[model samples]
Target: MRTTFLVIVLLLMRNDAWSFVVYDDSKIWNQDSITFYFLDGTSQQKNEVKRFSQLWQRYTGIKFNFTNKKPSFFNFKKFYKISFKGKNNESTNGAINGLIQFGNLSDNIIFRKTTILHEFGHMLGLAHEHQRQDRPNYLDNKQLVTACMKNQQQSRAWCNENLFKKFYKKVFIQSEYDPNSIMHYDISNITSKDSETNSNIPESLNNSLSFTDKFYIAMLYNPKLDKKTLKKMHKQDIREQQQFEAKANAE
Candidate 1:
């Protein structure tokens, strides 16, 4: 009986092997300039990227001096590029996240946006939010256990509780867990089977940069960036993350 209970617990833990897919495009990102490469395809994605870029600049206080010029295939680090694919590049249960492909191109802007921020987070050397040490227990482990059983055909009857308790405990830090963070997902949608959790999701951007849907745009490249003050800025970010996590855990 003890063994069976142990097996059930192991199924609840999220897979550690999974991580945000990163490409080598660090050459262009700098304090003064950031570049994006758009693979020729539909204008919609390009438009979106352009719009998002403008928005991103506003938030990060960084300018993405982008260009549509073709880059050397051998030198990918020069610019961040987007292309479409014939099929999806990731498995997220139809969620608009992860590597994407459309036709010969595999760039999904939804995934691209998330990937960009995640990669940028890496560029900043911020570890995964789940790996943060100050994170509260926001997820329902039992639900995850059931999900593992349903998705992987793993028997919930046999899981390792200790493995998860030790590893999962530090999956978030005081600086990292914002739910409304463009970095985070809707708790229900991220954990549940629903893909449309975006319907009622709150805004990720704060009040000052609230006009544009993209918070990064206003935050970056703003002449008034100095006014906000760094201490208040980062503190608000952490507090918001905690609030979101708390709300999600309650649900």
Candidate 2:
């Protein structure tokens, strides 16, 4: 049964159309405090996730409460349910649904931290950075397809079509292509283009949130910032990200 659910998740992760359905803003948790319940994972893993949640809370306005036993029926809707089953880690795009499925975490502390941070970004409604509409300017589709094929051990045809649709489809958002963002995947060997050159694309799987990441998250959660100001800041962030990517490629 667990294997079947994992397979379903894998399929869902590959279907970009399904992602659109999951990425609903109405699902975002509007409350200041949220609860989380662990259906699986070691105590250490749970602690790690809790720690990471706190790390994000420090930067944003939200708060987290971890519970060992499931909350009562009255509070069940108020808690996020987390499970460790799938081979690939995935989380519901926002808090309204309260479901997160994670894969194995490395014993290495740093690796585990980075993985959790990325997953939490998804929980906060952030999509993959590479899926940003502007990404094609910095990434080559063919090269990305090749990389996807190799990474997933799928056929070239499958990668070129279905996998590409699943992972690389353009997402419309108010943010830029922040390669340094924890939400960005490590595509160093896969990327075929960047501002400086096409070869030797710099790898970026951040262990922590980048400057733009912090700024964007703050903008997302802060009620003080108006829509116009947020748009302006997003543009500024794009400029900075472009400069950073260029410098990284030149190095």
Candidate models: Cα lDDT each:
0.38, 0.61
Candidate No. with top lDDT: 2
TM-score for all models, in order of appearance: 0.44, 0.67
State in Å the error of residue 48, model 1.
0.8
lDDT of 2 by residue, 64-165 (tens): 778878768776455577887776567777766467877766656665777788888888777766654445554544666766665556578755543244
lDDT of 2: 0.61
Q: What is the C-alpha RMSD of each candidate to the true structure, in Å?
A: 14.5, 10.5
lDDT of 1 at 215: 26
Name the best candidate (by TM-score).
2
